[model samples]
Target chain A: MGRTSDARERILTAARTLMLSRGYSALGVAEICAAAGVPKGSFYYFFASKEELALAVVEEHWAGQRAEWTRALAGDVPPLRRLRRLYESTEAELRAGRESCGTVTGCLLGNLALELSTRTESVRERLREIFDEQVALVAETVAEARARGEVTVADTGAAARALVAQLEGRVLFAKLYDDPGRLDALWADSLALLGAEESQGAV
Target chain B: MGRTSDARERILTAARTLMLSRGYSALGVAEICAAAGVPKGSFYYFFASKEELALAVVEEHWAGQRAEWTRALAGDVPPLRRLRRLYESTEAELRAGRESCGTVTGCLLGNLALELSTRTESVRERLREIFDEQVALVAETVAEARARGEVTVADTGAAARALVAQLEGRVLFAKLYDDPGRLDALWADSLALLGAEESQGAV
Candidate 1:
């Protein structure tokens, strides 16, 4: 039982890393198994198909990310500051990814959304839900900021969507250029989108 | 000579459609040829390899898009209005694509950028150039708006990058949800990012 569970964990870890770099369609089961150092039969035992494995990978990555997001967004700092922390964490993560792998892998969910959303219905639905959740999390912060008169935007949901969109967009560029600095504008841009007071010290 | 050129065009058209929906790595030369109704031999004749064909597709699509962008960004209207026109055109294009294909295919360049940027260096360089041009084009409009005192953004280039990132981010949502209406917030969000006067008729 221990060996079986270990194989599953190994497969998930390998798939997450491979999918981050090469995306979904370009990878094969055999390649993932080879990277995981597991036999091909173990893959079938863990994942009924490559698509199933993708769902597992998405869930696993999101679980970790959601925890981080929860931590970043739920602190003693001001609402906007917490939101800024989210972007900071994202940038720091990208910088670390580049330093370790020599390339920016970008947001795995965003990458999979762009690559497989249209082609894979299951993945598409999951991505839509994940993005919706991301927007909602940001919206909660925006709402808190609004209650405190920290931001001028009337629609917190719309503002949150814009913020997430900006993050994804900048991350795309960061990956394309292999430079995490592309995300430097995210905080200021987010402040602008939220209509935060100029006193917020946006640059 | 006419027939030869026609075959090349057919391959490009098919590749663009396929790449938009299924992405780059998911496709094969034979499938593109089958869709183009050209023989497999004709594909190799027109392009050296799949990567070469992708470059051709990128150039061809950009050629058409660049023309549209130039037309949208140039005119007697205010720079902000020109920018709004560009977004309107994009929304219209997405709506039309959905009507015809029953799915939102998203931006071909963005789809490819996320899918191929890490695995394919040549394509990565080209996508980087294309996005840079996109930022530059938008920056020119922002600069014009700034000169007219229509906006207050101090860094036109950075604002342009933010605007484009917002665009790509929203478009990703549009594609993921299979709903073009996801882009309706772009104009308002953009004006906010630029710190345009509230008198500018934003949402």
Candidate 2:
């Protein structure tokens, strides 16, 4: 069972790499299998179809993001600080990825949402839930900030959506231009979008 | 020469439809030719390669957007009003498209930027230029709004970027969630981001 689980993990890891660099539609099951170093039979044993494997990949990716969100954001720090840290860490990761990949990879969920959202209903629904979960996490932090008198969030829901959208949009620009500066400029702007302090470490 | 141009236009039109419904990476040259009702030789005669044809499609699409932007946003009206009209018209188009396509197709450039930005440098550069051009147009409007006392834009460039990102982000969500309401909510949020009045037609 342990060996089986390892094979599954390898398949997923390879799919994430290939899908992130190329796209969901460009890569096939055979390529994913080759990249994973797993036999095609094992690939089928793990997942029903390419779409199912992609769904599993999305789930695994979201679980990792959920863990990071809980760690970096749901801390005892100030709400805005946690949010800023989240964006900062995301930018750092994008920078690191650029060094190896020669370009920013942007967000996997966002890239898939753009490419596969309309093409597959199951994937679209899964992505929708992931986005909702992520937005709710941000909204919760925002509501906390408002409760602590740190920010004036007229509508926490809307503010969270705006911030998340800003993050995604900035990532898209950063990758497209091959410049992370495009993302750095958005940190203060995102706080301002929520009526939070535009300066650093402002509680 | 006229017939050559007609074949070129038809090929581009077909590529746009297929790419928007499917994606840039999924569609093949033969399918594009079949959809356009043009022969393979005509495709090569009109364009050197599939990538070249995709570039032409992007240029032609941007021209249509430029025409719409100039008509809806470049008028002598109040800057904020022009912006509102632009969003309104865009929403109208999205709604119309949804009625026909069963989902929001999203902005063509934005969709391509997400899917092809990392895979191809030429497409990424073309997209970067398109984004820059669009942002400049929005920045000019923000500056005008500031000059006319319609909105207080502290950093017109940043505000324009935020607005553009917000639009793209909202489109991503709208497509993923299969809900245009997600995009409709951004209208007031975008105005608020610029510190503009949320009232109707606040000239």
Candidate 3:
């Protein structure tokens, strides 16, 4: 049982790294297996197919991202400040990516959604669920800000979706330019969209 | 010579369709030729490689897009109205895609930039030039709008980039939800971002 679990973890780790950098369609199962230093049989044992492996990776990556988001938007801070903290964390992650890989790796979910949405239904469905969850998180914060009179918007749900879209788009630019500054604009503009001033964040 | 040119045109059309729907890395040269109904030999006769073909396609697609942008942002109209026209064109295009393919096909350049930027420098450089051209077009419009007191912003360049990023991100959402409403919010919010109201257009 221990040996099987190790192989599963290795395969997941390898798939996460390779798919994030190289994209979903470009990276092959054989390449992932080789990168993980596991046998083909071991890969099959963990995940039935590449799509299945990708789904697992999406869930795992989202779990980690959700945790960071929860921390950044912790209830202790005011809503607008929490949003700023969330973007700051995003900037920090991009800097870390630049340091580690010499380039921005954008969001795996956004990348995969673009590449696989038309080609694979199962993956697309998984992406929709993840998108829904993340968008809901943003909506929750937007609602809180509205309740506290920190921001104003016609519809919190639409605003949340727009913010998420802007962030994904900004991340793409960050990857394209290989610069973290792109994210700063995203941070500022998103705050503005919510009718909040970045300078007025809570202490 | 004429036959060779015809083959090249066919290849470009097929590639433009496939690459836009799928992605840069997902579609292969063989598939492009087969879809184009041309022999593999003819594909090589016209383009040196898949990357070369993609570069050409990017240029061709952008050229068409630039022409449309020129018309939409015509100086005769008020700048804000022209910007509105540009986005309306985008919505119409998305609607057309939905009618033809039963789904949304995001911008080819944005999709390719996300997929190929880290993997291929040549493609990334081309994308940069294209982004610069498009963003310059937008900045010119924003400057015109600012001159006419149609909108207010600190930096027209940054605002233009933010708008472009928002549009690209909105396109991705259009693809993900397979709903044009996602783009509607993008249009509304982008106008809002510029400190301009969408309802106040030229008579």
Candidate 4:
């Protein structure tokens, strides 16, 4: 039982790492098995297939993201401040040079959703829910600021969507060019755009 | 000589279509050759390797984007109107309910740049420069809009980058969720965010 469980954890760990390096569809089962240092037979023991394994990785990754931003937003920082800090931390990660997580691989669920949506409706729905959850969290942050008279949104929901876009897009850029500064640049604008002085002041 | 030259065209044509369907890394030389109806010998005869084919595809794709956007932006339509119309067209395309293009596939070159930068300086530089060209053109358009009082941007360059992010991220979302509504929402916000509403006093 112990070894079997260890094999499962190892497989997930390997999948996570390899997904970051090679993307979801690009990485092969053989490569993952080799990377995990597990036997091929051990694979079916944990997950049904590569798609199932990928879904597990994506779920685990987003679960980590939810915890992270939730903790950050829940901290002493105000809503707008939390948003800025979020962008700042992402920028810092990019600038810190070279250690990016899988979330920065443009969101595994997102990448897969793009690639496999037609073929895999189950995965698509799962990814959409994750994204919607994250977007909801962002919207709540926006609304919190509105309630506090920190920012005014022309449309709170639209604003939330843009924030989500800016966040994901910035990461995509950072990962695209391998330069975190691109993220820093975009995030600064995103903050200013969303936090327009009048827009915020009036609200 | 003409027949031999046609083989090169066939390879590029096949690659373009396949890249759209299967993406860069997901595709192989065998598929391209088969799709082009060219022999394996002909494929190797025209291109040395898959990477070489990717280079060609990247160049072709970039040029096409540059040309398409340039024409769209520089047509008889005014800058602001041109942007609105193009986005409307994009919204229409999204409404058609198909896979989104590579603008969100992290910019195939951007994807290649990040994945291949350490591996190849040439690919990295090409991607950076190409991305810059796209940004610069959009910046020029924003500058024109600023001059015309069609838009109000404190910083044209930042606004341009945001526009690029908006476009790219919208595509990502569209693909990610397999729902065109994401694109529609993006276009709506895009017009609201970037389109300068004419002053009430103005005609």
Arrange candidates by TM-score, highest first: which order? 1, 3, 2, 4
Model 3, residue A175: C-alpha shift (Å): 0.6
Winning candidate number (lDDT): 1
User: What is candidate 2's CAPRI-style docking category based on DockQ?
Assistant: medium
Across A1-203, the per-residue lDDT of candidate 1 in tens digits comes to 99999999999999999999999999999999999999999999989999999999999999999999999999578888888889889999999999887899999999999898888899989988988999999999999999998898988898888899999999999999989999988888988998887566332
DockQ of each: 0.90, 0.74, 0.77, 0.37
- What TM-score does each model's chain B reach against the true chain B? 0.97, 0.94, 0.95, 0.79
What's the lDDT for residue A119 in model 3?
A: 84
TM-score of chain A of each: 0.97, 0.94, 0.96, 0.86
Q: What TM-score, to 2 decimals, does candidate 2 have? A: 0.95
The sequence of per-residue lDDT tens digits that candidate 1 reaches over residues B9-61 is: 99999999999989999999999999999999999998999999999999999
Cα DockQ of the candidate 3 complex = 0.77
Interface RMSD of 4: 4.7
Winner on TM-score (2 vs 4): 2
Which stretches of candidate 1 lie above 4 Å from their native place?
A: A201-203, B201-203
lDDT tens digits by residue: candidate 3, A70-149: 89988987887888898889989989977887788888889888888888889889899989988999999999989988
Ten consecutive residues with minimal summed lDDT in candidate 4 chain A? A194-203
lDDT of 4 by residue, B105-195 (tens): 3245534543444445566567778877877887887777778777767777777777777766776676665455666555444444554
Model 2 Cα interface RMS deviation (Å): 1.2
Candidate 1: how many backbone clashes? Answer: 0
Off by over 4 Å in 2: A199-203, B199-203
